[model samples]
Target chain A: MNLNIEVNNNVLTAMPGDTILDALNRHGMNVPTLCHLKGLMPSGACRMCVVEVEGRKNLVTSCSEPVMDGMKIQTHSARVIESRKTIVELLLSNHPDDCLYCERNGSCELQKLAEDLNVRERRISGNKNNYKLDVSSASIVRDPAKCILCGRCVRVCEEIEGVSAIEFVGRGSKTFIDTSFNHGLNVSTCVNCGQCIMVCPTGALKEKPHIDEIKTKLADPTKTVVIQYAPSITISLAEEFGFKPGQNIGGIMNAALRRIGFNFVFDTSFSADLTIMEEASELVHRITTGGTLPMITSCCPGWVKYAEEFQHDILPNLSSCKSPQQMMGAIIKSYFAEAEGINPADIYSVSVMPCTAKKFEQQREEMTQNGISDVDAVLTTRELARLIRLFGIDMDKISPELADSPLGTRSSAGKIFGVSGGVMEAAIRSAHYFITGKELIKFQVNAVRGLAGRKEAKVMINGLEIGVAVVSGLKNAEILMEEVRNGRKDIHFIEVMACPGGCINGGGQPIGTNEESLRARMKSLYEIDEHDAIKVSHKNPYIIELYDKFLGKPLGHKSHHLLHTNYQERDVN
Target chain B: MKSKVEEILQQYPNAGRDSLIPILQSVQESLGFLSEESVVQVSKFLKMPASKIFGVATFYNQFRFTQPGKYHVMVCRGTACHVLGSATVLEEIEKYLKVKPGMTTKDKIFSLEVVACIGACGLAPVISINGEFHAKVTTESIQSIFETYRNREV
Candidate 1:
């Protein structure tokens, strides 16, 4: 059912229920939007996509209005443009005067709209709402002064993430976004996934940066600063340096970190391999010894915290293994310090992650071993890029270099841990090996692959039926968790990554990220898994050597002391 | 408190998103205001997030999060009241009581509120103190109103 529509004096075909915005977008018409999230229900709050339709007196919002047959639409008429400009001005009149020092100074949507609409002069000015900045959360900061009431953060928090940690509070002129009872986010049931920060178009919401602390530590001559980056950062960091997305910059990233004054740089993927070795062995032990039936992966800190806060009943089900970042931190301070003969106190451990929750994870009391903190500081991928730029390191000109030895080497299976289903796939590859002592005939589990929100797969290992489920986005995870709560007994293993599309689309990734970049990042990880010779974590000689030398075996007494930790059921308040 | 909220919530069926506002209103009415415990209980009953319940409850003027004072003073700031300089009257009241709208006096005797209208437009610039309406209020008359409330027996 194709309907003809005249858009901006050009005839365009639309589907039966296609909106004018949809038809125009299909025809390559560029219309700006602020409150419009990609897949969520259309909320015509921003009024930025308002277009004039013939036979209609008022300019209807194209996002909400459906295209009628033979309807004429003008996307950018003088009247529409003026209305948008006025709206921008009205928003600006209430916004703060701190753009020069704002985190999203260049990337703010309100700032961009003002420039696009040529709103140079302030036509209207009045009393701006002076709300205090909320810096309570470990991962995110909320400044109500910069909020334009776009409701993107509120929607993303509730709709996409299912946290609903924050919402629109109060009425009309006094309306502001806040958690329940006007308490800070730290007290709220915020899992600190930072998805709200990623969707926020302004500097109102941003990752709580530890850049100053990192810089101070780096400059300290006595401190031996070491940094480890997550696997997803390698593929996504290239975008920050003006390179195309999915460019594997692993070696160059090592070189860049070297130039940025880090004494040592290691890859969290090595620990990711180490994680599979332990996690897979744990799953096998659980199946054989009548432990927890479906052991959930605890690699994602966001998911771990969610379990601690909301899903306390499922705590026993979570694999007792710390995340790869924490694992690397533990081994670096203990194993690496023992080998290098450096004092653990002097080693300032830092990690660059594709997540904001890593900051919270590193600070968790359970992550500490023997009263000494494992990781000193955690930086998001965005923060690492800032450090690179601050040091004036030319990423493109730097020659490729490998990571530091012993805790550096990793399998391609570990590298794919950055994407959704990769953890389950990697764990399955090793879990099969742990159970049967042979590699899977088909290492590539096509069932658990791709960008599905919730994925399920069944595999037979040594004639033993195994059911596995992979879920990303906490909302999607909640649906599967509901089934688990309802006594559904099919699944034997489950992997939950809080951010949608896994770490490739994590909250701390580059801003303005769309579907194309997400696909590219996921493809790059799969490509590494395809091309690399060592595809399985069990196949990684370094992992086997680590067990032979320091850690006796996976889930052994020594490994449990160093690599594993417990969770505390936190108050939901 | 838990038993009261549970009793009010038991009237609604097991699963319904639309029951949130009504449940919240009932809980607020029974408890005098929605406490953190009441909100959490409502969330458990309806299986809704507390943040969202707060979002809906804060939308209407009929609901109040804080407990009302013994002598709740609601000053009208409607179109007629505004034209008659009710803003000055509100300022005088705030200065005299040493409290702003949405805040109770330190003694807990008076709580100030700015309402849109009280439907007594013919008597423009009205201020209601504990169900008693004073029409055509002025900045000068604010002192006498507070005096009357202060001297009155509870």
Candidate 2:
């Protein structure tokens, strides 16, 4: 069903399903859009796309309005321009005029639109809405005053990523996006995925600033800053520095870190393998003892935070193990520091991750084991890019190198931890080995592998069908939980990560990744998985050596003291 | 909606003042307003005092205890709204009502609320007075729309 619409002295043809803006864009008419994210549907909130309909008495938002046959529309009329200019002026009035100092100054859509619309000044005399900047968490910053409330952050959290931590609070002039009950991100149900920051047009949302602090510490001669990279960071960090998506610069990354004056270069994948040993054993213990049904995986800090907030009723079901990063931090301070005969206080631990939530997770009071913060500071993949650019490291020419000893060496099981369902698969490999005392021939668990919202698999472990469910994104988790509550779900174990596609598609990774980018990155992860010799966590020499020398065994007295954690039921109010 | 409300109320016969907010929300969802009879029924259903329910209904701004005007006009005064010339829209609404925000005219034709952001910044100067979202509102449009609703009521 083709429709003909008269728009701006031109007759434009459109399909029945085409929105007015869609028709305009097809006809080479650019209707300004801000909140209409490509992956999501039209919100029609930003008035910049207002166009005059000939029959209608007033202008209609082209984004939401559908084009009909024989409809007369003016894409650029005097009234339409006036209306758009007014909207832009108004948006600028309340917005913080600090773009010169903003990190997103050159990249901001709002700034571009303001300039395009020729909004010179705000004629309306109004005081800026003052909202206290929130720096409660390590990963993300919340500057309420600069927030346009376009709901891109809210929509991204709820629709795409499926973590509904942010929502509209208060009524009329007082309305703002708030974490549950006006609490700080640290105290709220937010998973700290940082997707909100990714979609935010203004500087209202950002990774918590640590550049100055890191610089100050680097200037201190007494401090030994050791930098570590997550396995996923190797796959995505190149994109931020103008390299194509999925470019591997592991050696260049290490070189870049050394250039930035880091004393030691390590990998989180080493601890990732360690996490598999502990987590896999814990899963087996639960299965044998008839403990919490469907013991939840705790590799992702965002997922852990979500479990702490809305699902505290099922706290016992969560694995007692800390995240791989935290596990690394605790081990570095205790085992590695002691082994090297170095004071833990003098060792500054820095983790470069594809997760913003890791920052918030590191700040957990319980994470501090020996009077010092386990991980001193966390830099996101994007932050690492900034550092790389600051140091003028030519990423294209550099050769990929291996990470440092014991703590940096990783297995295929650890490398796969970057993708969704990888953690479950890794844990299963270790669990099989731990139970049978034999290496499993077929390393891959095909049942739990994919990008589906919720997946369930039943594995015949020694003739017993071990039920396991894998869910990515919090909304999917909610659906699975409802099924559990209603007695409809029958799973012995579950893996839940807050971000879509798990840590590979983390909130703190490089921005502007589309379907192609995701595919490319996913391919790189699987390639790493297929090439590695040590495919299981228990098979990793470092993990086996660590247990033999220091930790004794998984869930042992010493392991329990450092590796496990307890959760507290949060106040819902 | 009413049947669902009745069923929910029956499930919580021993509910006290704590159940007031949920009961009020359920009631509002059903009748669109917390009527006197519904409030009494809620009090009797929960086995709590009627005064307590009334007190809670009036406390939360979300509770619309009174009958709404024929045309509900909620002008967003949120930070996003303020930046988008919402004040001019508010003035236009006041001119039509001959009363300030949070008040209805003598004819009970329109009720107003200076609401926060409706999460529609793209179409700023938005108003969802009676559940119908009107975006990019101008001074002329507000006056003409008021007459349209006022004429319908008369």
Q: DockQ for every model, please.
A: 0.71, 0.03
Cα error, residue A85 of model 2, in Å, equals 5.1
Measured against the true structure, the TM-scores of the candidates, in listed sequence, are: 0.96, 0.75
Measured by TM-score, the strongest candidate is 1
lDDT tens digits, residue span A263-319, model 1: 999999999999999999999999999998789999999899888888899999999
- Per-residue error for A97 in candidate 1, Å, reads 2.6
**Model 1 in CAPRI terms: which quality?**
medium
Model 2 Cα shift for residue A567 (angstroms): 1.3
**Global CA lDDT of candidate 1, please?**
0.89
State fnat for each of the candidate structures: 0.69, 0.00
Expressed as tens digits, the lDDT of each residue in B110-131 for candidate 1 is 8888899999998989999988
Q: After superposition, how far is residue A13 of candidate 2 from its true place, in Å?
A: 9.6
lDDT of 2 by residue, A184-239 (tens): 76655467889788778878888986666787787789988888888889889878
Model 2 regions lying over 4 Å from their true place: A1-31, A37-42, A49-59, A66-86, A115-129, A157-165, A170-174, A179-183, A396-399, A437-442, B1-154
